[model samples]
Target: MSPPEHRIIAGIYHLSKDLGRHFSLTDINLQVTNGEFVFLVGPSGAGKSTLLRMMYMDDRPDSGQIVVGSFVSTRVTRRTIPGLRRKIGIVFQDFRLIEDRTVFENIALAMKVTGTPMSKIKQRATKILTHVGLYHKRHDFPKALSGGEQQRVAIARAVANRPAILLADEPTGNLDAVSTRNVLELLFKINAGGTAVLVATHDIEMVQSFGQRIIYLENGRIARDHEKIFVGDVRDRMDESRVSRRAEQLSEYDIRDEENE
Candidate 1:
């Protein structure tokens, strides 16, 4: 008999949060499994990031049972957070790399804090940097690298310790076509490696192109959730004149017809 997969199983039962006297999340429920790549789509102020923070254990829900993997997150003690974090990776919209740290140091810092051996730290950092295609910029500081490069460095740091789940928020925001493709491709590779990835982004077009299991939020509720095929015709005809204006840039990086592996 085979052992169970190390799945990042999540169950948010009636999740809610207090924000200036109102509940940010209104009874949210969700679940995911290993090797699953899920996308979260919603407009600004929609509770996407708040939900992610809860999953990452950064913020506790006001009322609900939140569980990830085998741990109960709702009332998880402070002493156990570090251990829980070791099993999860989180990427932010701000690209939270230390401005003073070089790319290699940024990646190594995660393991260093966890008391990883110095010998293994160097090897692990280098491998993740190469994995994200940032080996050439390993010596550069965050301020010196472009937005996309900095984000890749952030990704390398997140994956350096080999996390079971990765939660990324607006990872491709403000990136050019090429940079977005590169970063998303790196994420796809990570997902292929069996790490569950959940990315929150509002790029509807990109969402349509990537074609993954999506959890769409609206007014603090689960508006839509499913894996759907990318149909360019509907989108193109919805706003014919608008799409025509942006067709050149859109077509350059569109992956609507690409065969999913």
Candidate 2:
């Protein structure tokens, strides 16, 4: 196993809502190692988004702590939060691109805020836009692109700084099947390049075939955390009917049984 510096560690964390009427999340403990691709899956209100937020330091845990690289939640201050965020990339379900900015500018802005040199910003932004297959539309505003294209640009912006970890929340929620596949493929490609990727989503059928580590969240707690086992090429299992059948099989496993209990 790698040392703590190479992992995202959450230590017995807890959080609640509505003045403690109910716990939004509790007893959460997990670690994401550098360059690993993992999925955080659960139904809505399962605290998936909240966990991501805490990892990035957007919100602090009510108890315990989270450590991302060298930054520790127990020691982080407002003045240092930006420094921590620069080491992590974040993507949202809704395309959060600035409507008024061109695709190139949207990506460049991310680099610019981090004080990247202008020459390098132009160079990196162009490379990322081309990598995402949207260089041709670099001058177009967000509204000018299709939904899939917009999401690709959002991904480009998210990773513009080359962060060590990328957190994506429900990245395919609004896309049609084809677009969803495309966006997920892009994420896989990025992960292959050695950036740790953690994606949160409620759509289990879309991700079960990938054979990656999956941490199942239910009622604000982790129900299961383990790598999935699949036979043959994962791509071969991606057909709709096959994935649906696999999902059915998974429901009989411990994760689903715990959910029922």
Candidate 3:
């Protein structure tokens, strides 16, 4: 295994949030490793959005800390927040593209704010727009596009900087089934290229089949953190019949253990 410094992408340690009479989050602890894809699932009031905000330091926890790359929430300042945000890509359910800007300008703006040179911005924005299948619509404004196309543009803008981590909150909430699938495929493609993705959604059924790590939040607390297991190819590749039988036995034991618990 790699060292913690090399492996971990984001870490939340004993974080909590208080919204006066109601608690938004309580003692939340979680870690996302470099290049890992994870889902944060819960009901609407489960503080999923709050946690994502905290991770990006748009809001700070009442206690404890959040560490993303080398930026620490406790130590980060107003002037440095933009610097931290540059390392993270954030996507929202609502397509937040500027109505007046063209698709190309929307993406280019992300790079521009970071002082990326005009030539490099044009090259990177063009490449990202092509990747998202929106190159043809580069000159079109947001109001001229459909909901799905607009979301794709939003995603393109989010990743224009090639951030280390991507935090998406209900990215598919407003899309139809087909559009949702297309958006998810885009996210998977981004993840495959080595960006750590932490997507927060209330639709468990939509993401469960992907076989990635899932953390379940309920009432501002983590109810379960489940990791994926590989049983398909490993089971089929067993050298001997007895070994296969042994694997089956172990599987049975695991099931029984879960039932007992």
Candidate 4:
């Protein structure tokens, strides 16, 4: 049997992106290992989308090395990029499914591009559609579905090839409360199946519930990286909700230290 692959699927070393005066990512370094579930959290415009884009090869970093599987983002040639992408899957907040295609066709096409056989494509499409609770609408066009349904199709298509790493940007941003829970649960199910999942989200309750490793960003830098601990929801009006409470606590500590000095 072939030996097990490296635990680290991707490694980012001193990665940075600058668009003239706008710096999206600054000296960001991290790693996504095998079967790990990580949340990329931050306030608006914290460069969360930019980071995921760089990971999936939508854009290259202005400076730094991103090693995904075997290809290095800084050095991956255009010709080799397509191959590099075959090992990674990506989903966006906006459902990018083809409006003209049926739900089954949307997912089937993703696998077809990878040269999956017609018979296997049919089987995989049915299985994934059922998994996402969309098999009943397999024949429906994306235009006929709601936002949540469309997003579900996008996710099914993204994972059609069973990639090693799944990058999701606000997967539940367009979903309703129930749909949000459904999608989040589906992501957890996928992660349980051994696909390393990295999600960038704002739903504090979901993060608090899972209590997974959270990578919080601020001003294009990883402000904090740690697990979340929910000490009961306060339902308060304070700006420092559960997500920012850690930062708030750190600020309090600093104040106490200054007073002691």
Candidate 5:
């Protein structure tokens, strides 16, 4: 075999977006060596998404050094976004699947848009769908599937291109306990196969259960970085009570509270 690939991503002095102001990612250096599974944890509105967005070129940093594999993302042009996107897979919590399309079609669409040949599309799509444990549901549409299944289809579509890096944002937010375990197991398998994985999530319990290396952000900067710590039994981090729902709704009012003061 040829020589092994070196580090997949490296960044130092990253300064990106903030809430209507500049944020300092300066002295914020990190390195993701090949085959590493890393977690990016933080509170909501703490720039976790913004940091991840910079990696995929959805948002550019004001000034920073970023290198992904061989591509210098901070210096790349807009024309290179498609190419970069093809090389990195992203799993979104909202499951950005097409409600109108079947699971197989949704996965196939990515390859097709990238100009993948028709002959190879079906083979690759089928393989990845099976990899994400959705081969049997290939004919089902997003609306027909459970929250977990829909997220699985999203994962399938993301990894269809066999990207070098996979970025997942709150992937297990809506999933049940069993589904969460399955999804995390699947991610572990992917990481074991030499893909660099980075996950941004608020599922503290799941993160604790899995015990992976974690980088936590607070108020737009890393607050505490910790090694994977297995502290307790697996637990559900979300609450489905009406009070929680009401509290979520109260965020709007809470914002008003800040304004009133």
Candidate 6:
């Protein structure tokens, strides 16, 4: 028998969204697979944010079906939304870190709410901060960091739980040229770690240059899906299975310690 296809992490079928009688998204169909990095490109009001919100189930569609991990939008309830969110991570254009909390505390909040034990949470948080090149500022508050630094914190927090998919909406919007490059590089590193990444941005030049999959949204629909299609790891031809770099595997020392214990 063939292995199960858990690679397809998300799917949208004939989806539509409305904003107070204004239809924001119309008949959108899309899929994101494991270990793949995709770009969602569109101008403002192109429904990029709206589509991301629905994928994470912050809002349900008015006309179609959506699925992330195991929770189907048509079947999931408010009570189940938390569980669904646990399997996915999201970063917004605005650095939504807690203003009152230190950087460490802000990242810790996500793991804490999901019932992560203190020991592992600390280990994972430290490792992820380093991964995003912000370990030196862990003691600082969000306001103390520059805009680029703040976004790095947000990205770190999102992946702290090692979600199966990471959705970032305009993560570079508030950044300058250097900062934008830095943030995008970090995101690619995250993708290399094996978490499927979907970036929603209006940067046509960047998206085109990346040479990865690009799903262009216009008005409220997907006008184009530009990609080089492949089944799985083209490197290891024997096993075409999808691969992922989970959040827990960020630090070899921590993983080894846990195993030794």
Cα displacement (angstroms), candidate 6, residue 51, comes to 0.5
User: Candidate 1 on 123-165: residue-level lDDT in tens?
Assistant: 8887888788889888999999998898898888888888888
Candidate 1: clashing residue pairs, number: 0
User: Quick one: best lDDT, which candidate?
Assistant: 3
Sequence-dependent TM-score of model 5: 0.80
Q: Where does candidate 2 stray beyond 4 Å?
A: 1-21, 228-261
TM-score of each: 0.84, 0.84, 0.85, 0.83, 0.80, 0.84
Off by over 4 Å in 1: 1-8, 21-23, 228-261
Candidate 5 lowest-lDDT run of ten = 233-242
Q: What TM-score does structure 4 among the candidates reach? A: 0.83
Worst 10 residues of 2 by lDDT: 10-19
CA lDDT of each prediction against the hidden true structure: 0.78, 0.81, 0.85, 0.81, 0.75, 0.84
Candidate 1, position 34, lDDT = 82
Give the number of the best model, judged by TM-score. Answer: 3
* Model 4 residue pairs with clashes: none
What is candidate 6's local distance difference test score? 0.84
- lDDT of prediction 1: 0.78
Model 4 per-residue lDDT tens digits across residues 1-261: 996574899788999887455757889999988877889998767778888888878788989989999989978888988887788888888878888899999999899888999999999999999999999999999999988788888888888899988999999887655456556667778887889889998654557545577898888898888853533222331233343454455568768889999
Screening candidate 6 with a backbone cut-off below 3 angstroms (N, C-alpha, C), the clashing residue pairs are: 193-245, 194-245
Please say which candidate is ahead in TM-score: 2 or 5. 2
Candidate 2 lDDT over residue span 1-261, tens digit each: 765365443333444322144746767787877777889999987778878888898877877678887888989999999988888888988989999999999999999889999999999988999999999999999999989899999999989999888999999887755567778878878987878889999987667768888989887778898774653444444555434454455545646669888
RMSD of each: 7.5, 7.3, 10.3, 10.0, 7.2, 11.6
Clashes of each: 0, 0, 0, 0, 0, 2
